[model samples]
Target: MPFLLAAALCSVLVSVLLKLARRLEVDVGQAIAWNYVVAAAASMLVFAPAPSALHAATAAWPALVGLGLLLPTIFLALAGSVRHAGIVRSDVAQRLSLLISLLAAFVLFGEPLSAAKGWGMAAGLAALTGLMWRPSKGAISGGAAGWIYPLLVFLGFGVIDVLFKRVASAGVPLGAALLAMFVLALLVSLVLQGWRLARGTARLGARSLAAGLLLGLLNFGNILCYLRAHQALPGRPALVFSGMSLGVVALGALAGMVVFRERLSRINLAGLALAVLAIVLLARG
Candidate 1:
């Protein structure tokens, strides 16, 4: 429970930091790139993952590479969603991505459907519609463009979750898999940033470096605590899952409202409520 709490806190803190990064003039791309470096280093140090096991033939290269590409991309999307949609909506969108993952399970992997899952999916779709609604003009914020980020955040995380599930099913060691993915992600991020730097489109700054380092620590803490939670509750992953999902939504809403003064309409709040219920249902399923 302590581990689960810590993971939830760290997850929300990541969004808060990213929200602040804009105000602090931090280069998000640079920070995210450097974040991978820090995360990879921390993962290697803490897990002591065997490098020999990462050989191309032994490792799940395709899934690892896919996650590597998706991680930074979805991270950027998360930041964007936090900025435009507020942490409340962004966090809900992220957690509700379980819906998409469940869908993928049914479709791609042919996982059996249950009554709980059916109800959860129905509620989750409604939650998405409600969360994305902006009361001001009967449309989502950022016009069509603004809505894309959160939608992407939702879909992107779901896709990443699916990949992780596949990797886990293949009997890959979690630590080694994470290490490989983070290292690959760092390389991919560097290449993208390098291109931007050459084009004079982005500049790396000291603030970006510092923020990236901090973000890396928080990000790693989130993963560490989450894994610990699973370790603590070996047979009941659903408890950890529900705890994490609910904790983030509740805390994120409070933080966005109190610390950031972000506003949410009644419909948005309703969506958040439904999201929480949906997560509970999915956990039961």
Candidate 2:
């Protein structure tokens, strides 16, 4: 339970950090790029992954490569989402990605679609609709891309989940697989950042570096704590998953409202409520 709570806290902290990037004058791209460096190093120190598993005959190279390409790019999308949308809505949209993973389970993995899960899917879709609904008259800095970024975040996370599942099915240990992704993502991020630097678009800064280090720590803590939660309760994966999902939503909302003073429309609030319901139903199913 404690590990679960810590994991959720870490997750929300990640969102909050992204939201604060603009105000803190932190270059998010640079921060994220540096984030992978810190994360990859930490993975090596903590996980000590067996190099042999990667060379095994049944290695999930395709999935690992996919994750390598996607992780940093999706992280950029998430930063855009949080920058454009309030943290509350962004977090809810992220957690609601379970809907996509559920569909993948049914279609790709041949899992049964129970009635409760079906209804949960319906509710999840409606929640997404409600959250993305905006007043037609509003002319803010964000236009169509406001909603588009969050949708990307939603879809991107779901796909990442599927890729992780694929890797797991290939018999790779979780620690090793995670370490592999971090290292691969780090390489990808470095290349992109190097291009940016070459173009004179962005320069490496101490602030971004510091922020990235912190982000890396929190991001890794979230995963490690979540792993601990599951280990502590081996027979209750559903409980651990649900707790982490729900806790992030709840705490993220609080941080958005109380700390950031983000305002939400009635429809958005309803969407948040429905997102909670969808998670509950999906977990039970």
Candidate 3:
């Protein structure tokens, strides 16, 4: 439980860091590229070459590779979503990943679906719809790219969670699994960035580097706690993840109000209240 709580706090902090990175004029791709590099290094230091860890890591490479490939896509889509939709809306939409993974667990992994899980999923859906509902401004609205990006991000994350659980069940050491995943992701990012630099499509700057380092640290802590929580309570990853998502939203809202001075409309305020209620139900369940 404490591990899960720690994971929730770290997840919330990651969201705050992402918002801050934007204000600091950080390039999202660069930040993500560096984040995985640092995370991989940290995981290797913590878990690799300890004799006992080698066997688990050897067996986990396949799932880890799959997870690694999904990560960049998830981050790219999430960043795009945050750019198109507001941060609050993007965060709310991404929380729907929990429902996706829960369903996947039932259908694909043979996990039992209880009434409490169903209710939790319903509450999550209601909260997401409420968050996305917007009052018309009586003008031509944009197309569905914004919505599609976030939905894709949600699906990517859901797949990641399922893969993580599968690897865990297969006796893969979490730290080793994370290390492999990040290393592969880092190599891919480097290749992509190298191509961009060669084509003169992007230039690396000091601000971008610094933001990447900071995001790297935050992401490392976030994944560490998340994996620990999932390992500590394998039966309730969805519940823990829901709590973490709610914490991120609450923290994001507070940060928006304080740092961005973003005012919430009456409807948004109501949505926030429902989000809180959903969290309560999730925790109680």
Candidate 4:
């Protein structure tokens, strides 16, 4: 239970750090690239993964490669979503990704859906619809792209989670797999940032490096805590998963409102309420 709480806290802290990064004028792309370096290093130190057991011919190389590419991509989208949609909505959208994962489980894996899960899916879908609906007539900075970023966050994260499930199914050690994925993502980020640096589009500096280090620590903490929760809970995976999701949404909303002074529309508030209920139901299911 303590592990679960810690994981939830770490999860929200990632969003908070991203919000702070924007305020501090940190280069998010460069920061994220550096973050992967820190995360990969941390993973290596803590898990001490053996590369011999994770050979390309036997391991889930394709999935690992895909996750390596997708991690940074979704991370950038998540930052954009938090910037444009407010952390309250962005966090809710992210938690609600369980809906997509559940659907995929039913369709792709032939998992049986319980009545509670069905109801939860319905409520979650409604919540997502409400959260994304913009009744106000003011123009956001990136037009529809700004508003759509949350949905992208929702879908992208769901896909990532689904792919991770595939990794688990492939008999790969998660720690080792994560180590490889983080290293790959770090390489990808470095190459992209290097290109941008060459074109005079971005500069590598101390502030971004510091922010990335902090972000990396929190991000790794989130994963470590979550894995610990799973270890502690053993057979109660649903409990840990639901608790993390709900905890992040509730705490993220409070932080956004109190610290950031983010305002949410009535529809968004309703969606938030429905999201909590849906997660509760899904957890029970």
Model 2 lDDT per residue over 28-94, tens place: 9999988888888888888888988888825698999999999999999999988888788789888
Q: After superposition, how far is residue 205 of candidate 4 from its true place, in Å?
A: 0.9
- RMSD each, Å: 1.6, 1.3, 3.6, 1.6
lDDT of 2 at 36: 86
Task: Note the Cα lDDT for every prediction shown.
Answer: 0.89, 0.89, 0.70, 0.88
- Those runs of model 2 whose alpha carbons end farther than 4 Å from true positions after fitting are 137-141
> Which parts of model 1 have CA positions greater than 4 angstroms off?
56-59, 137-141
Clash count per candidate: 0, 0, 0, 0
**Largest TM-score belongs to which candidate?**
2
Error of 1 at 97 (Å): 0.8
Which run of 10 residues does model 4 get worst, by summed lDDT? Answer: 137-146
lDDT of 4 by residue, 1-285 (tens): 899889989989889888787789899998899899899999999999888758743657877888999999899999999888778778898899998889999998899999999999999999998777776553233467656899999999899888888888888887798898899899889888999999999988899999999989989999999999999989998899888988999899999999998766787789889999999999999
Error of 3 at 82 (Å): 2.7
Residue 278 lDDT, candidate 1, scale 0-100: 96
Off by over 4 Å in 4: 56-59, 137-142
Report residue 162 deviation for candidate 2 (angstroms): 0.5
